[model samples]
Target: MSRYQQASHVFWRCQYHIVWTPKYRFRILKDNVGKEVWRCIQVYSAQLGCEVVELNVQIDHVHLVIKVPPKISISKLMGALKGKIALKLFSKFPHLRKNKMWGNRFWQRGYFVDSVGINEDIIRRYVRHQEKMERQEQAELALD
Candidate 1:
């Protein structure tokens, strides 16, 4: 076999930065709830064969930097993550089942995704900063 043929079979590292918010942007993930939500995200990501490189659960949204196999479609991966987390969260915390949280859906229809190319460090820092940003926003809102 040619060297070129052997090189073609190599797998490239793929990193995906994803961000999504709750339906209607509800601030349901407060205090300890955020930890639970993060746990659910971790569990779901593991089930989907994705490595959770960085993750932050804010009051209204979440930021996740994951490394997924090339075989998975972005939509399918997102759906699986959202679905599994939603089921686990709602089942664990019945209050989240209220219409305010989401009657039938856990996440909003749209999500932000970016390929972390050479800026993986920047994206990781951004994901980690999500919680701090959320806290600052809450503090600002409280001052009003």
Candidate 2:
């Protein structure tokens, strides 16, 4: 499981690996643009009460691993994030807004999100050692 966070009545761990590409897969994110996008995501996630565990901005797409609260729906979060980030980029980097082909849109409408739940190490240990644990218990029972 992911690192759980607790409130007075809520103890939860909900994380996701999200991937989104630019419109028509244009390789526009580079240098300042990429850095700015990364910063925007980080700052915005924090502002929205989410924790950005990892962010990778590629030329055409971005990969973000984030810890989000159970209360927020993924669709709503993405819609807000994509819209705000696009507006910020268009304003700060006017050249990006000038792209006629892209018009005013920056990101693709559809995005990919996978639940990053249940760590690999724990699964591996359980799969490899469950029989051993059962055997140890059986031995102890026989002694008693």
Candidate 3:
């Protein structure tokens, strides 16, 4: 199980599974470019107080599993991640900008996001039990 981080009052374990692809699903991320992207991800994630659980930079798409603090919203995080990575890549690999599709885009506008942690069944069972206990307590009081 993943460990939780605590704030002054809130305890959170927010992890997300994210996947995105380059514009048009081009296989631009390979070899040195892919390696650089990986490095930037690690560096930027730490800067944003996120723990990168797993990262896979494939030829056409990238996959990431990360734990982010509650303070950072998912949209904000994704914007920063994609924006910064694109800037860094265009800077290091100037040739990429030559292509029309790559002229102003790196990753596609949207990405896949899903919450990852704990089982839904566990939460359902916990809630049901609590409701049952509450109902039983109320019934006993009514009979008294």
**Among all candidates shown, the one with the greatest TM-score:** 1
Candidate 3 clash pair list:
none
lDDT top scorer: 3
Q: For model 1, what is the C-alpha lDDT against the true structure?
A: 0.81
TM-score of 1: 0.82
Candidate 1 vs candidate 2: which has greater lDDT?
2
**Model 3 score (lDDT):** 0.83
TM-score of each: 0.82, 0.79, 0.79
* lDDT string, candidate 1, 13-103, tens digits: 6788999988898887777667887988888778877789998887888889988777788899988888877787788878778765466
Error in Å for residue 138 of model 1: 6.6
Candidate 3 residue-wise lDDT at 72:
98
